[model samples]
Target: MTSLPEDPPSAISEGDRDTAVQRLQEAYSQGHISHEELDERLHQVLTARTRGELVAALASLPEENAGTTSTIAAAAGRIKRRGAWRVPRILKVESAYGRVRLDLSRAVIEHPVVDIELQLGTGRATITVPRDATVEFEDLRTGWKDTRYKPRARSRPGGPTIRICGTMGYGRLKIRHAWR
Candidate 1:
């Protein structure tokens, strides 16, 4: 049998291609590659017309990062729990495509002025307001038929005042903290 040169043929060996796929899979499972990145890379590899291109793709493994914790709190003691005093007089909140809940069951007896902003892609929101506080609704934009306001039969004075700005796509929003 004749011995081949150190350099393999232009065609990629089955073992080399398999090893590349394995390395890519391991990188993804170990969280080294994001789903979008992995998909793009895999697409590039599988679509390579020549063996050299495939080999070049296989050699492009990204560097590993240990990640930083200066901005991340890993322990329970590092978390900040605000007392009643820190509660905002006017709670301004914003979100997209999801409902947000604000629980005031443990709130102090203080008049709160709340401002809410939501850019919902497709969802609903239900807000529970204490009785007696006045509410004002401002509709920025909505894809739904109309915005519905469901209020409690009773009202409580000196409660929270709610101001809402929202854009809903086939969704509903309820602001209950308003006093009528």
Candidate 2:
């Protein structure tokens, strides 16, 4: 008598692959791996067919840190963040009468999702996110002008999701994806 073969392992999804890639990028940024290593691992993650392969690609990486919330407030001045800055998992921005700009094109984002809350009064705010990121601002309330945002034609799978909320009083909010 012959026995049936064991069931094949489940295949990995695009989301799974994207998550592995993100973890690898974080590890690379934190100096856990070199450029060549990151390239190799990324290739492995992208080409992985099964969960085991994906897990193997992420071996030896440090666990993610607990998410923390940060607040940035300006009573009557300009607030800007650019260059190679680290983005927290949760951020709150409050401006009474100042312009605020957050450029996240080259920022180091280690989390899968980021939450940004804004409270502005009589000031404008401009936020630039990563090219591959997904932005959501449905919960934002504006008193003067509607929020300005143009989503990517086709957002990549497994990219970070940025959630924006809060209130804008007598001001405008502009959100755009980074070009570079």
Candidate 3:
């Protein structure tokens, strides 16, 4: 088997393309790229078959410069991001033998998409998102009962998208849609 030196093709997993999609959407929301450009690149990112192709989709975007704002809800404590608190671009929640609730139904989102990472240990997390918002939580194990997030169609533009990724052991994270 011979490989092309210029375009060395490698399998591009959905995870790889998803990261590129996230970057493209962020660039579009930040006004770094036009809507038409976003649509074009998004198509490429979604349909990319090779690593080279996915890499090209994000080749033009600037490096990630967005600052991350993190928080930890320790054991035996409860934390809530509610009321008028300004939503940060990146929010991290770590709860150990505690409970954490992020009520995004009333949160003032500063970005079109928010990346939230959770680290839970024998704790519980409840996320409340607005009726219009979409949540994508990857494979997560919550003790004996695994949290199952049904995959929906790719989120539409102009609405908030929250991507939650993390590792949990003997803990549970629940997402509830706004009621109203």
Candidate 4:
């Protein structure tokens, strides 16, 4: 007898649910998905407690952030995100003798929280966010490199959260916030 597959845990957090909702709304706005489809998917998103369910609900619609371009700093190269650029929810960065800078003061933030994962080898990564937004850095393994995460507040609370997680090898990771 073929047994049923085990279900994924239904312990999704609020942040994940909000992110899924944002995706559904974006899909509907893009016209790739109809109202009926969006309604069905959105219901699933709101009710979903597991990552698998959320992923399944959003599997049919095209990723709203598909057009959002990601920046990369290759060896001896520098990549920056400034001006009016789309702020991707997930940013991947790697550099050897290079730099990656992202200024979120005027960028389009699609989610409540942004996750930046990086692996640097003798390089530097800088992030500039708005003062209203909250920023946190965790699990950074910088091997004898300079690091700075100073974000002064000038705006009220209840803004988007930015989580930076990565490993640094002989590199610097600086995070600062601007009043905009």
Per lDDT, the best of the predicted structures is 2
* Reference-based TM-score of each model: 0.40, 0.68, 0.56, 0.60
Q: What does candidate 4's lDDT look like per residue over 1-180, in tens digits?
A: 997564334344566677778878887887878999989988998888655567678776664665453646587788777876657878777777777788977665655577777778876778888656788786667787657976652434445688877788877888887654
Tens-digit lDDT string for candidate 1 (1-180): 996444222343344355556667878898877888778777767766545466456554643221211121121122222223223344444444444454433333222355545455655556554444456676547787566666645543434466666566766665554221
Tens digits of per-residue lDDT for model 2, 1-180:
997564445355565677678888999999999999999999899889865677778778876664578899889999999987768888999999999999987676656689999999988899999877899999999999999999987665555789999999998999999874
Clashing pairs for model 3 are none
Could you tell me how far off, in angstroms, the CA of residue 90 lies in candidate 4 after the best superposition? 0.7
RMSDs, each prediction?
Answer: 25.2, 10.8, 12.7, 12.3
Cα error, candidate 3, residue 85 (Å): 1.6
Instruction: Tell me, by TM-score, which candidate is best.
Output: 2
Provide the overall lDDT of each model, using Cα atoms, as 2-decimal numbers.
Answer: 0.50, 0.83, 0.70, 0.72
lDDT of 3 by residue, 1-180 (tens): 995444234454455566678788889899999999999999888888865567678766876655768675676688777754556788888877677888876565545578888888776678887555678876454554567444333333334678888877776678876652
Displacement of residue 94 (Cα, Å) in model 2 is 0.9
- lDDT leaderboard ranking: 2, 4, 3, 1
How well does model 4 score by local distance difference test? Answer: 0.72
